[model samples]
Target: MDNNSCGCNVCSTREDLPWEGRGTDLPIAGCRFTLYPMTDRYVDIILGSLEKTDTSYVWSETDALSTVYRGKLPYVADAVKALFVNAYRSGVHMALEGQFSKGCPGDIAGDSLLEKDGEAPNAKSAEGIHFPVKCKLALYPMGVGNYIDDIAKVWYMAQDRGLEPTTIHYATRISGDVHDVFDYLRDVCALMDESAVSHYILHFTVNCNSPTKE
Candidate 1:
């Protein structure tokens, strides 16, 4: 055990104890998500999306309520983005709610994914897919002081990316192309200060192809 390593869950959750490191070290990441496509063909949409998206670099498990995908950060993001985009339809409304987490103590169930190599298999196939989506994300930078400032930084990044963010009570809502929205969310997870905030979580909800006016 090094100076940065800790054994207690409380310390890890409170971020009072640091782990080996999250940067470049490739700490495990995961997201559990549920997708709702508001159309009679929702069953087809869900099944088709799952079949179309590649999960070669990620480990995934699905059940009645939601699906959990875990792996290296980038691969996880790739899988997530591909899944949502593959399921999108021009006329039907679709929504996905997900909880993303990284560096949780004892979260090694998907450690095997680290052994897999190469880029996310879905990355190449998902290219050039574009559609509009409305998204809001609540980022929790665990144990970091001035956390609100960090959140504001993400908001600013969204604006810079032309996402058109709107401040809501608990989360910041942004609207833009699905590709950009997913990329921004992925960038947030990858670009944060890994040493300062060891464990961070994001509650994200995104919807697309909606009939309702906004």
Candidate 2:
């Protein structure tokens, strides 16, 4: 068979096909983020909190820097939100930075491919691609005292409206439907101004594109 003939719906005889046209479905998508506990007490609380059972995600912690969670988009978001909420309830200052992508980006998690007919394709296979939604985010608890509580108020408000966030040096990367990403951002912004903190900070970068292009 010719290089252009893969005998699959994904393959066409056009070498000039744009990356987006190559495939629309991806098998695995995820995000990477770093959690920052502003104080020693907050650090301990955050680390200890992660020690609990969380079957919804495949997560890893690196001593005192960050944690990487890989799994379905919804599960990842839920896990991050729960962590933030629980940490805030402890009354400690904290922040989270992250990035989310639908298709494999550097295979940071190492599970970017799926087996197909006893072999894995060298490139992204449409059979396993998830919907393409990419976003970057950051969450910070402001003020010196009672900041966690202040941030918590905004956190829940964002949740009430719906937002999920993550970081730089460390980032929480997530990929999914375009609408879902937008909804997450909208909620984050809504809480930025309502928090009790003197100045709550939230940062975001969003992209909707194919894995190949990302």
TM-score of each model, in listed order: 0.85, 0.40
On a 0 to 1 TM-score scale, where does candidate 2 land against the true structure? 0.40
lDDT of 2 by residue, 54-164 (tens): 523434344454566555444444555444433443333355556544432123334432222222111122222233345555555433356556545544544444344
Candidate 1 backbone collisions, by pair:
none
The best candidate by TM-score is 1
Scored against the true structure, residue 83 in model 2 reaches a CA lDDT of: 47
lDDT of 2 at 205: 50
Residue 189 CA displacement from its true place in model 1, Å = 0.4
